[model samples]
Every structure is written in C-alpha cells, then in structure tokens.
Target: MRAPALSALDIHLFQEGTHSRLHDKLGAHALPAGGVRFAVWAPNAAQVRVIGDWNFWAEGDAMTPRTDGSGIWEADCPQAAPGQAYKYRIVTPSGELLEKADPFAFQSELAPATASRIWAGTHTWADDAWMRARATRNALDAPMAIYEVHAGSWQRENGEFLGYRELAHRLAHYVKDLGFTHVELMPVTEHPFYGSWGYQTTGYFAPTARYGNPEDLMYFVDHLHQQGIGVILDWVPSHFPTDPHGLARFDGTHLYEHADPRQGFHPEWNSAIFNYGRHEVRSFLLSSALYWLDRFHIDGLRVDAVASMLYLDYARGPGQWIPNAHGGRENLEAVHFLQALNRAVYREQPGAFTVAEESTAWPRVSRPTEMGGLGFGMKWNMGWMHDTLRYLREAPVHRRWHHHQLTFSLVYAFTENFVLPLSHDEVVHGKGSLIHKMAGDAWQQFANLRALFGFMWAHPGKKLLFMGGEFGQRREWTHDGELEWWVTGLPGHRGLQQLMRRLNRVLTEEPALHAFDFGPEGFEWIEADDAERSVFAFLRKGPPGTAPILAVSNFTPVPRENHRVGVPLAGAWQELINTDAGEFDGAGWGNLGGARTVPVPSHGRAHSLVLTLPPLSTIYLKGPTRATNA
Candidate 1:
C-alpha cells in the first residue's frame, strides 16, 4: 500500500497556521485501502522513520518530507494495525536520535510506558437529540449547576481506578439525582504523572489511559448526554511538563515551546510554556480543542490557569520575565491566541462553550471577542468564594466586623457571566474541607455551612461545587484517595447533602433565580446594611410577569423573633426552603410554613412581614401570587 498524501489545501492551511482540523491530516490514520498512514511535523529533523511492533522496532519505514517546504513527513505502514504501540524515530540536525510519541495520537500507552497506539475511531454516537436541544439547555439564561469532579478519585473499586465506562453510569446517575445540569471533570487528558492530576499534559488528543481507552471516554460523554447531563472538561494550555518523551525539544529544538527560558518556562509550575506567538502552535492547540468537542461529544471546555497566560509577569519577580512591545505586563501574543481559540471553538461547535478559571479582575472575560474581551461563556468567581469563606471562618461575634465580606460580592457580581465556584482548589493544600472551614461548634458549623449554601444558591450566578462538598467531607481533598463517601451516613452530613439536592432543585425550578444571572435586573437589595445584627435580605426577580422570591440570612447564632422584612407585594409569602428546618438537622425556628404581609412599610416597600429568622440560617420565600394570596 502506498502512503496517502495530504491534499494541496491541507498543506496550505497547515503552513499558514489556520488549520483547525489537523487531526484529519496528521497523526496515524487508518487507510481504508490497506493499513495506516503516519504523519508528523518535524521541520528540523534530518530524517524521520515509523518504528513500531509491526516493524520489530526497526528503522526501515522511512517517511518522505513534503515537497512544498511544509516540513511534514508521511509514510505508509501496511503491517501496522489497530492496538499496536508505535513511536517516531527522528534524526535531528545535531545527529541526535530522538524517540518521540506522535503529538496527535488518538490513544497513548498507559503512563510509565511511553508509546502511542494506532487507534481508528470506532465509537458510534447516540446523542443526536441532545445535540439538537443543547442550544436551549446550555443557554446563558438557563440554570447551570456544575458538579466539579476529579475522575481518578471520584470513585474506586477495590482500591483501584474505575474505567470510564463504569464511571459513566455511576457519575451520571449521581449527578442527575443531585439535580446538577453538568459535570466538570478535572483534566482527563493524558499526563505522565498521576500526582499532577492531568495538569501536566503530554497527549493533547488522547484521554488518560489510566481511566480507560479512547472509546471508553467517548462512552463516558455519550452516557452523560443521554442522561440529560452535560460534560465539561478541564483543558490545560498554559504549560506542559518537561518530559523527554513529551513535546519538549522535539527534533532537538524548541519546536512546541519558546527557546528562551525567560519567555518559555513557567516558574511557579516548573513547566514549559508554549510559544503562542508561533502560528503553528496556535493551530495545534485550536485543533486539540475542537477534537474533543467534535469526537467525544463534550459540551464545553473549562480552560485552566488562564491568569498565567494573560500576563507576562504572572508568578514572576522583577526582571524575571519579558514584556510586550508596549512595555506592559500583558502578553499580546497570548491574547491573540486566546481570542482566535475562542472564536474557532464557538464557530466550529455551536452550543458548546468555553470557561476561564481566571483569578484576576480581567475586564469582560465572559464578553464576546468582538466587544474587546477574551470571549468566554463564563468565568469562575474567585473573589466571591474567598470573601464568603473568609467571613464564614470568623466567629459569630466577630462576623459583624467582616460584614462587607458577604455583601461586597454584589458590588461587582454582574460584571461578567460568573460561576460561583467552591472548587477542589478550596479543599486542598492544607486549606481544609468546607465543613472544617466554618468557625463554631459542630452544630453551628453545620448550620453555617447550610446557610452558606442557601446564600450561594440564592445569589445571582451559576453554581459549581466540588464533589465532596455536597456531603460535607471532613478532611481536605486528596488526589491519591477517593472522597469521603461514608460521611453521608451521618445525620448532619446527610442533611447537608439533602440541602444541596433541594438547592439544585430550586435553582432549576425557579426562573427568578436563574433567568438574569448575568444582569442586575434579577437581583434587588432589600436590606444590605444590617451589619450590626449580621443579617442580609435580598429579592431575586425574574422577567416581567414572574413573581419575586425573597432570600434572608442570619449569620449569628441568636435567633431574631418578629424580624421585619419588606416584600414587593402585599400578600401571603410561602417559605420555600428553610436551612434551619428540622429536616436539615437545624433547630426548627422559622415562619410556620408561610407569612402574610402587613400594610406597615419597611425597606422602602409598601408591605412587610414580621417573621422569626432562624439562627445561622438562610430562608427562601415565594409568594404574592393570585392563587395563594388573592
């Protein structure tokens, strides 16, 4: 069999650095006529050969370079079949022989073994209905409760990792039962070290073989989609590990990364950063992003460590980094690369979105690219998470001093389409678990946690809670071990889990809580300056014709009887959820199911309800409807 040649257009686009579908041309593709066609980009290589088990690991199958000066080598291996491990044998300009894995491999050998496997996509997709309806399901106005999970440690069988096929059913059923709209997986892409948690990626196009094969990962996404659950993958483009068999020093030069350490090396992570100024590198990353959405049916990508990519001086001291042409801290090349990546993703995969895990206050991160922004669908709200946790850590007596921590988030809440993330980062690295972060006795701690969840759900943004937080895991998160699944057996922990389920339910069922999450129209402050009593009251409103829902929270342990809270309408208000209710392991102190508003004015409203506010609890009320009050 003769090697299949790349088309004229393929070569042109690849050299021009605009090829978003390079996977179709490069990598090992199974030719229908006979065997496999292997292609790789090694412009500086003196010679390249295809060596694998089929050829007894010999150097006979030499690849021919393209005549168009594109520097891509191609070869035909009639003997190469699926499942066989293979690698590239490149002779560099310095006469150095380098054994490198194919950069565009669809499947890779399990870590500790460095080789790429010949894989032809064989998974049959059954998600047409989901693909068709996802536009509405993933709309900006729709309720989005993301459950962030680390696949390797989410669950285990006999102290071993469960394959993707097994994890798919278990994770899907669990997320669906908890009412989460999507599952955000912590990077499942292949990495050399399990300790890195897939952040030090080596295989851009392959799922980590530790969990399962390429087909198994596809089944994971397919199963989630079939169960009405969207899948979001954590994508790392900021830096990669300096593994010799990886992308570093390919063809005996910095082919994928910058040659200068000042510009290429990531000081904080001790990894190599890609040269975003290189057009070919941009095409490689863009193709990788599209491959997952196109082949695996993934709903979205949550880009990790975007803050490091945006600023040149990130994690660097003075004179340790290079600046842009304007002598600013920003990396203009990275900015352009990010804009192109986002534009390509949105254009190629309709309804699929991208999120940024950016900690800095970069303006308009979630805005459109045309509007002079980075163009992400949503951004993680690090400020809100930090403020809320800091406030919760203070003792109740001192909470009054930190009142701004709770209310300050609302000052800039609508600046971007935000996702209130209580992510794995908060529960690791000696930060302790969410339950342990609260400052009080056991009962008060649980109550504070419950109140925090209530406040988060009622706040104006999408919600994302890490895996073990729902059940109140007592220990810090560990990538080496599974979550504390047994904690759910305890009453307080079980009650917390129950509250999470109810919170997700309310977030989905109530339009007022989700419809305008990105705008100020959805939220109105009823009473934001109750610092003396450590209390807050707010109203979440929907579009016209929808009734408003009220949220009131008390941070202190002392209950407030006859607490006067204003309401928008003069009628009956039903207590939809009370974190202090006995069902959630709290003292049964609340308005007896509902409250009727009096004509007395309060908080600039025409009517008010004099009700009992429970200690360390948040309650949501909905009412003033014709069916209930008229």
Candidate 2:
C-alpha cells in the first residue's frame, strides 16, 4: 500500500489546531499515477473501507491506518474514477458500521441523494484584471452596494433552476446594469434541505450540485469577477445540522461537535453547534473557509449568526448553557476561533475581507484583534435597520414623535465600519416587502420607500439591498419562487428600478458619499432638530478638493417651499437626485434644476440654500466644488 497521504508535519499542525490547508491533504484526490487516493479522519474507527460505484460497494479494499497515530485512514484505489459516488464504511470498536459522506468532498450529489462524488476542479479563470485590482475595490472607503441574492430563486426557467453558468451571465448583466459593486450570494454550499437555503451545510467544500458541478460554480464567480463585480458568500460556521451522513457522530463519537448537549446543540436553530475548542474541528473549518477564497476567488464572506456564536447564553435559559473559564457568558473558544479566522483570512487573502452579521452590541466586532476586537472587516447595522423600518411603518401624522429613530444611527455610525443592510430577513416570515412596510397609500408607500432609499444611500455607511427590492416587489421574499421580474412593466415599479440605478450611479460617482463613510469629518447635520416638521437635512463631505453633497428628507406629506439648509461653500448646487421627481413617479416638486446659496444665515452657516422639499421625499444636491469643476 502507498504511504499515508498526510506527512509528519501535517499530523503536528492538525493536532496543534493550526493547520489551515488540510483540504490539500485530506479527502479523495486524483493521483497522477492512476486512480484516486482517499483519506479521512476517524480515530475511533476500528477499520475503515472505501465503498463506491467503482468497487461495487464492497469491503475488500480496507484502508491503512497511519503509523504516526494520526487516526487518518488512507487507501489507493486504482479502480476508482472521477464522477463515481463514494462513501466511507467505518467499523467502530463496538462492531457498529456507519456509512458516512466524505466531510471534505469537493462535490456532492444533489439533495435527496447522499453520495460524495470523486471530482477535481479544472476551471481556467479569466478574471485577472478584477483579481489584481480587487484590493482597492474592496476597501472600506470604496463604494460597496451589494445586491443580496438567492441563486435558485433569483430566476428560474419554466419553474426549473438555472445552472450556475446560466445564472452567472444573467446575474452579472443585471448587477452591472444596476451598478452594484458586489453580489452577495446567500450560501451555495451543499445542503440536504433545499428550503434551508444552504445554511445547514453538509459539504463545506462542495458547491451545491443542485445548481451545477464545482467547475460550473467556479465559472459563476469567474464571470462575475470578469464583469468587475465582487462576490461575497454568506457562510455559516456557527452551527451545522445533525444529518446521519454529516459531521455528527463520526467514528461513533462526537468528533466535530461537543458530546454535551448544553454546549453542542443550538436550541433556536435545532442544529449541532461546532465544538470550537476541538483542534481538528478548527482545522476543518479554517480549511473550508480558505478553500472558497483560494479556489473560487470569493471577494468576501459574511459570517452569519455571529451573535449566536459569540455568547454562551444565546437563545438559552438559565442552567441550559455553560460558562467560560472566567465564569462569563461569552463563548471564549468561539471568540478565539473567529479572531483566528479573520486573521488568517486577511493574511492569506489580502484583497478579500469578512463581514459579521452580529445583531448584538458586541463591542469592537469589526475592529482589529490586536486592539482587543473580533478583527472583522465590517458588521451589519441591525440597529439602524430595525429603527428605520420601525419608524417608517408609522403614519405620517405620527412621524414627528418617532423622528429620533432616523437620527439615532449617526450617534454610532462609525463604530465598526458598518453596512446598512435592508436584507432578506426583513421581508420574510410575514414581515412583508420593503414597499409594504411604509405607512401610506399606494403612491405614498412608493414615495416613502424612495425617500428611505435616498436617505440610506446618503447615510454614512456601506449599503446592501436584497433581491426584489430594486423593483419594489409587493410580496414577501420566498426561497421557492423567483422575483417578480414582470413588475418592471408597471410605471411605479419601473420608476423605482430606475431610481435604484440612478442612486447606485450617484453613490459610485461621488467620492463624498463613500470615501469618508467611516469618518465623522465626512458628515454634519444641518437640520437634525426639525422633528416638529418631520424634516431632516445633513451634509456629506469628501476630501479637500472634492465637492460636498447635501441631502434633505421630508417625512411628512406636506411640501415645504423655501426650506433653508446651511451650505459650507458658496456655489450652484445641482439637484443630483429627487425621489419625488416625475421620473420616479412622485409629486415632481423640487428646486428647478439647481439652487444658488445666498448670504442668508441658517443652521449656523454663513450661506444657505432655500430649497423646495417635496412631500414624502428625499433629495440630494451636489455643490460645484473643485472636483466637480475639474
């Protein structure tokens, strides 16, 4: 028999919990000599055998255990060929036999089937330009408007799912047209349940075969990168489902998760939580994370359910959870794992970054590890999303009393390099669509949504809008159905789509909007105290030579003529965007093209512009500064 696949150094690192590239050594690999070399980690197994279509599912070819005591079983099967589905038949010490799918399999059979396929990636990438310059494009200061999408539901042909290659061209064209900088895919990793939306991951290394094979998914990312759109995958390292063929009870033991239910199980998700304290499990997760970035060239990863991972008492009542060594509620092991994960990601994939979907007010979530932080690149602004949505649901007559919701986010806008996400979570489980959340009639609802978007874009943070939102889909998001693509035929919906395109263009074109998003100097309030009138105004500033942008919002239904807003510079301010303009299906009440600041004092500024504030709308005006002139 050939020597074991793992070397002495691999054994040391895997045991030490620092091996980041275990994928290259473990799993089934096509040997250059002939056939495939299979390896798996099952220390408690008395014997392990490779069973597959090539071997007639027989137990004749028993795997050899490593002499180094690594508990890894290896077998060189010259008869095993690519595309053959296989599983490890492990015999436990108590004579119990368990057939398990390869944990490190790069490709798996589609849902309703539980076989791992023998495959190797052979995709030739054609995204050199995007890969080379992605560092600057993915920076915190860059304009990043992500269009969150579910691959299967985004679009389907004749009620059938489109392959990854097909979704690639169509999605890239649509996202490019809308001017979104990135497309954040809701997990495409292999899962047994289609309705789980890839969250209950069974094969971390495999792209779901329901869409396409490994190379086809690779083409998906490559094509999007070629079109200058970064890809961010929603990754769930927090917990995994306890399917019989999955990571649960491997080798007749809780190898990947804790044996104690209090520490291992997630009551809310009804899944098994990863035992972050385990050395080999850490290597498995870290390797899984790097595999996507290395093989698929993913631009970033949005770590889902981070708050659940951070707290031991999360979703648990007293005595149902365990405390850390310091007797605190924090999951110390998970904290170390997250910090290590982020450090490894940044060090290995310099251009790529990570975001945390942490709902709690966990301090320094996006800060660096050395600064006593979690070391994530960004965190979702759940507070802002919840507050803004709650305030928008109120009637216009009652908006004045809840005006603080609109202004409260700025108090901590720069806390963790936030991303203002109006995500799919808000539109599911009877929450209704974003348009329906507004407080008004048909026209006013549309107007309120438009104003909310305008204010969001002008706000100091990165932006993310889920699918169906660009065109104002009237129903809640369903993973089983496609977006209402036909709604673009309607005047209001089409106008909303047009507004999204225009807003994205303005966000990307203007440095003042994105360049200083995390800096307080880039923003200032001009009329934050106008709760009685339910009006708000603010200024967004860029670098020295760049032009400044003024954004004003009227939450009420009454239009205000000659609403004086302070201006820092004396110049002709052009109306860059008015959500109420006739083009956006609004009242069409706005300043006639531009407004020139006068010597009149207002809002503590020497010069002020008397502007027309349309009802239930927000407008952005660009000052003619040196950058605009140049």
Candidate 3:
C-alpha cells in the first residue's frame, strides 16, 4: 500500500541528462568527470557497481557509489561515454546481486545485456524544419489513409533484406504511388529476436541488426517526408522481452525491473513489464518516446498492445488476478507514465501524433491532458473493427444489420478521434483475406471486397488499409513468407488493386469523405433500407462549399438501371466512383463522362442523385448542391 513518492533529489537525476537545451552542441552537463559517469536507482540496495566492457567483470571495473539524497547510486567510471557500453549491478538490502542497464541512457551503445560503448553518431538536424513542418501538419480528424507494413518484409528483393537507404528509395515511391497519406511501419527498434514481431524489445535505442545501421532508419524516414508521406513507428514501451542476452538479468540483477514476479514478469507474452514507478525506468521509457519523436523526424507512433500495459491481469486467471487500490484493473503507474510520455512528446515536438492500439475498451484514450486523459492524439477503434467485421461476416447485402452494431462506431467516433483500420491483424494470424470473409464464390468475393471498400470510403471516419489489400491478396498473411504476389497476376486481384487506386483518387477529389476527420457533423445517413431494394446509402458532407458525396451500394447480382440515392442538396450530380467500373474488375455499368440528376421516392425531392448501380457494387454521387435545396 506504500509505494514511495519521488523526493527532491529524485528529480535531480532527470536534470543530469535532459538539462538546459539541445542546441548546436552536446550540453556540458552530459559529461561527468575523468572517463564517463554512470548512475542507477536502487533505493533498498546495500551496494551498487557500474559494469561495462571496460571492466571484464573484474572488481576494479566494478563501480562503487553511496546512495544519494534520492536513493539513487552514482559511479564515476571510465566505461561511460556517448558510445560507451555499460550496465548497473546492485547488491540489494537482502544480499542479492542484481543487474540492469542505465535506464536513462541516451543510446544503448552496446545493449541491455552487453557492456557500454562510446558511440559518436554524427548529427545534422537543425530542428527548425522539423518544427515548422510539424506546426502545419494534418490533425487527428483529417482523412488519414495509413499504409501499415512490416519494415523487414516490405522490401524483400528476392528474399534479400534491404537496408534503410534501399528501402527509403523503394518504400517512398511505393506509398506515394498507392496514394496513401501515411506509412504506419512496424516496430524498427532493435529486438533480440525476429519471431516476436518487435514486441519483445530490449535495445530501446538501437535499430535492429536486421534493418541495417541506425543511420539507415533516418534515411528511410527523411526520404518518406520528401515524398509527402508521414511515417509512424510502432513503439513498444509496455514490456521488454526477457532474454538473458538482452534486458533480462543484465549486469547480474533486475535493476531496471521489479525483482518480484508479481511486478516483473508478463506471463502471457513471456516478457518483463517495466516497473513504471521506478525513476530510472520511467526516464528510460519517456526518453525512448521522445527519442523517436525528436531524432527520427517521425510524424507519429502507434503504441503496441496498450491493453497489456494498462492491465495487471493481462494473462491472469480468475483467482490469480488482483485489482488495484481503486478496485479496477487499471495500472495507475502505467497510466501516469503514459500521460507523461504523451505530454513530453507533444511539448517537445508539437503536432506529433501519439496513438494507442488497445484492443480492450480503455476510456478517454484521445482525451486532452487537462481532462485527466492520457492526451494521446487518437486510439485504434478495435470495437468498430470487430463489430463491422462481424456484421460483414454474417449479414447479406439485402439483410438488415443490427442498427446498433452498424452505428456503434458513431458513439465512439466522437468519444475521441478514431482510425477505422483493417490492419495487418485482419489478414495475419489465420484470419482469411478481407475478400474471402464474404459469403460467395471467388468472383463474388472480389466484388464483395470492392463493395466493402466503397463502404469504407463512404463511412464517416479516418481510414487505414493494410498493404496486400490493395490488390486482393488471396492467402492469409504469414510472417515467415512473403505476400501473395502471384494473386496480383490474376484478373480478380489486379482489379482490386486498381479499385484501391481509384478509391484513393475519389477520396482525395471529394471533400465529404474526409470531412469527418475530427467531428460527428461530417456524416449523415441518406438511406438504410435493405428490404424493397437490395441496397443501402449514406452521405458524407464536409464544411460549406465542400461538395457532399453520396455512396450507394447494391448487394444483389442484378443490374439496377436507376438507383436513387437520397441527397439534401441539388445541382448537376456526377458519378465520382463506381466499384463495377472496368478498372475495378466489374461490368463497368456506369459512364466515365456523364452527370445525372433524378428524384428519390422516399424524400420526394427533385434534382436528387441517381446512378446505374451494377450488381454487387458500390457508387459515389458528387454534385454542387443537395437536391432538397434545389
């Protein structure tokens, strides 16, 4: 019940590394005497020492320092430096030898389990450009079309890995060509293994060996910016994989983590959850968040497995799990740490988005800091993804969808900013392709995908589609192998890719689709009937003077000559997009060069939008004004 509070001297430790300002040169405060000075927090420890490559585990190499005013130990050792590799060894009050890294390390010159190095990477960033550009960047509510991909697999040329330079050259154009506004890359931080998918991170500052050198990562990001695309790194701060050669048992003891299994181990993932209440660990996690934001020119971060971080019972059985003092599963320390991380990142790099990908319903994920919220820019709407996928799986095009389930997103859309993503999770881990999820033959499946994409464009929220979905990747994604490249050669899959290109184009040309970028006023339903006609419709309207777009989907296989989509405004309406167009692997029932206006029976409004909706297809109607006004 008594987790001690930070004392006056505890705050002094932060001043050592992050003091004054980051200007033309490294601050003098970073240096501490003859060689290098290393320090770690171990309040109840009997003795402490600094371990590094310099000592070779010899007593002379071991550092000795008394507990400071803040309960932290300091060791003026020769092993510390900008590139120096080192870790901490603490002899606890109970006579147990423990070891961990300098949790406040600017860079892990070696690694968690390895000794220190005196790394001297060259820096050329002025921060002027980064600051100026960040000021005018897109907001959370804007039309964000994210292209999520793993860095290692995205640019495999004949099974060979591409360095940051090669990937920068290739990925930038690939994203721009596909018309995605943002690139949400998988975690790039150095992890000990390749199988954990960067979740079990140990080297918090080092980019992985699999991804080439550290500078290579910088080149990739800078190149992406040059291409007018934003990059978001998937950051893992919640836990670190327990590898003996990594963060676990470094220097000899659990210096950066909790010694007790209750606080130390994460059973489900076989990782070690950070002790957020610890001063050094907090500094480590916070600095890691800021490092990516400041050093990389990265636009944002998609925090991985936020649920695991916020829960004490993430993997606990009914009786084994315990609640916090507040009678909730919420981890207050982790919550506070997250809030601080967001606050620091935003303060240092304004407009830089920090998004959480929590599967469970964590409230106020996108709320402002002043409101007791974590102050994240947005949260992945996993509920929307799950609900929508369920509806799509069972309900036929003509069948009525549970009104609540279909509209459930709207409730949370305004709760905090949201991004509706059909991300890698949809395809990977045994889930079939988006197209395959539909109930139909292969041809119908592709059509279903096209129609669903049309629905995505018409819906009122931000959008994100995983890589292989562009051209209907047939097989479920596998981390061990490449994507279904052969599927692109097939007409059906090729059509899906073309349709994807068209979807982006239309989304860009129309304002209403992106209007809901940050508010509820952006979407208005025009129709939801599934009985009389085998179709449903909706309207996405931006601000005034921004054209309102009507999206209509026909689920049946019968060609309907005149399908009326209700509209509030008037003027010459045109078909902006149709999934059935030849470009999208359909019969191309609509015209490429034409405008049409007709009345809706239900609305009894003249000058309304009408179009030739092909079987199992979707179409968008865009015009100057609403038919009701006309």
Q: List CA RMSD, all candidates.
A: 1.9, 1.6, 5.0
Cα deviation at 182, candidate 2, in Å, is: 0.4
Off by over 4 Å in 3: 1-10, 13-60, 70-118, 123-131, 246-264, 395-405, 531-534, 591-595, 599-601, 604-607, 625-630
Candidate 3 on 1-630: residue-level lDDT in tens? 311233344446443433112211211113434465444545566776766667765453443434344445555554445644556666666676766544444444422234333444654543445446654545754567888887776657788677778888887887788788888888877765676777778766667657565566777777777677788889998788776545565445575666777667887877877877765567666667777777778889899888888987888866555577888877887888888878877888877889898888788888877898888888888888887777566545534544445556766677778788899888877788777777577777788788888887677667888878878777777666566777787888888887777787777667678856567677765666454455767777776767777778776667787655556655577777888888777877874544566544444444456567787788887767533311
Model 1, poorest ten-residue lDDT window? Answer: 621-630
Residue 218, candidate 1: C-alpha displacement in angstroms: 1.1
Which is better, 2 or 3, measured by lDDT? Answer: 2
Q: For residue 200, give model 1's deviation from the true position in Å.
A: 0.6
Clashing pairs in 2: none
Off by more than 4 A, model 1: 1-4, 625-630
Every candidate's lDDT:
0.91, 0.93, 0.69
Put the candidates in TM-score order, highest first: 2, 1, 3
Clashes in predicted model 3: 23
Model 3 alpha-carbon miss at residue 238, Å = 2.1
Worst 10 residues of 3 by lDDT: 20-29
> Which model is ahead, 1 or 3, in terms of TM-score?
1
Q: State which candidate, 1 or 2, has the greater lDDT.
A: 2
- The alpha-carbon deviation from the true structure for residue 245 of candidate 1, after best TM-score superposition, in angstroms, is 0.7
